[model samples]
Target: MQGHGYGQPVKQPPHTAWLVLLRVLFVAIGLFSIGFLAWAMMLRLAAVTRRSLDWGLFIAVLAADILSIALLSMEPGDEIRTTSGNFAMFLLLGTLVATIAYYLAADIRHFMQREQAYAAQRTAQAAYAYRGPASPHTPPPMPHTPVPRTPPATPPPQRPAPTHIEQVRAELDELSDYLRKHDGRHDSHESGR
Candidate 1:
């Protein structure tokens, strides 16, 4: 018996402490920062909505990015002489690496899980459902009551066609009437204002 039997405590692989730490970091920093960054952008664009906490995270991330860029731009000959500067550089770089790694792993895992779910659904459907080609048989018969033939459509009663000049005059009259009504109202409204 190489494997543990039923009801017996199975010998599972030991949990990796680093994996747990990575998950915590991923949720705490990766998700939190990304969400806040997006929210802050929306708030900035809208101009009316403001949440200070989200904006704080956005600013912090932006500062970190700027600092990292500066650190990377420095030549190998140049170095941070201060202890705090060195620590900040190391912390920024390490966090960037960890965030990238966690995001990539999480994304790949999500994709794989979705793919597996879709595959399983397809397999289950294929196994249980019979989806052969549609029957070659003719369509079903209509009701026993014979369908009545439709009568030919009659043309609508036609009005006497007006001349082009008359049409234009009619339109002009409508426009003049509209202007007459609105112009007085506009004058009264402006006077009131």
Candidate 2:
């Protein structure tokens, strides 16, 4: 095996001709599908828009498809094997080609216009988004810093200020203690006597 660019052997298809044929077959299918889709789309557009020219073209193409199919399927000595039949086939095919071309062109134009509109809309939006300063006179406001949400440090609970009545009660209790001490000393003196 011959080494490729990266020191790897080039892998080849088992049947290159068969693969090529398959690709051609798929391409043909895709093209036919696209052609049919265009035909359908033109018919719908003609109906919705009520355009006489589009309707005529749509009918012509439909007739072309039917006639072509019939002609190709018939045996050589059939009734449609005459000069008139050949002329009809040619006219139908030409009409089909012209109709396909017209619709394709119209579709392309529609898409291009849509793309341009979208681009213009995007540009307008971008212009709005990147607006200049409202006024070149004043400075811009400072960016706000978010305060951290830590729990507040609670202060120790404080005693309320003493009331007048409570202060008087405290003084009276001190005086009673002093009088008790002095009266005990006097009682001791009397016992000695």
Candidate 3:
């Protein structure tokens, strides 16, 4: 049987593995830039730890990209070609990291919203059930009386609609009965045969 998917596992984005690989590279670049290359790492450490690591990583990535860009711009022709590979890698990793992060955040937000809605609905149903009926004098609504069901009166045992096959069978039976009435075959047909 044919399926709509390309054999990927359920509920995963198409390029998730590639995104994961890029994230690894992105992390390496971020660590390298902040650890030994940039002087602002210490200054940003407290803020980044307190707030969001994403902003710190983003700043590190930016500094790395700028450094790579500047180094590549100073290189000669063939050297530039060789060194540009690192810059390209960083650029591609950055884009993938940002894209995956955005999508992940959106997915988390939607999941939280869906969970909250479900929780609200459950609470509302619980409250309604606890409150019972609006009027205490009124009896609880009896679950709809069951329509006095009596096997639907057996619907008079209706004969089914005749399909083409059934009609053909009946016609064949009628023909056999007619042949039997006429001494098995028409005289003219037997003579011709």
Q: Each model's TM-score? A: 0.30, 0.38, 0.27
Clashing pairs in 2: none
lDDT values of the candidates?
A: 0.48, 0.53, 0.47
Q: What is the TM-score ranking, best to worst?
A: 2, 1, 3
After superposition on all CA atoms, what RMSD does each candidate show versus the true structure? 30.4, 31.4, 22.9
Per-residue error at 120 for model 1, in Å?
A: 2.2
| Selected candidate, larger TM-score, 2 vs 3 | 2
Candidate 3, residues 1-193: lDDT per residue as tens digits? Answer: 2323322222323254654564455445445553233223322332323445545554654565566556656666645365465665566456445534543454344344444455544543444344343332453333222222234445654678753333544666677778777974577678887
Clashes (candidate 3):
0
C-alpha lDDT (0 to 100) for residue 33 of candidate 3: 53
Candidate 2 residue-wise lDDT, 22-125, digit = tens = 43453343256533333464575476446687788777666666666566456366556766567655655565456556765654444444444555445434
Order of the predicted models by lDDT, top scorer first: 2, 1, 3
lDDT of 3 at 135: 38
The residue-by-residue lDDT of candidate 1 on 92-134, one tens digit each, is: 6565554455344543443444444555445434433443332
Error of 3 at 78 (Å): 9.1
Superposition TM-score, candidate 3 onto the true structure: 0.27
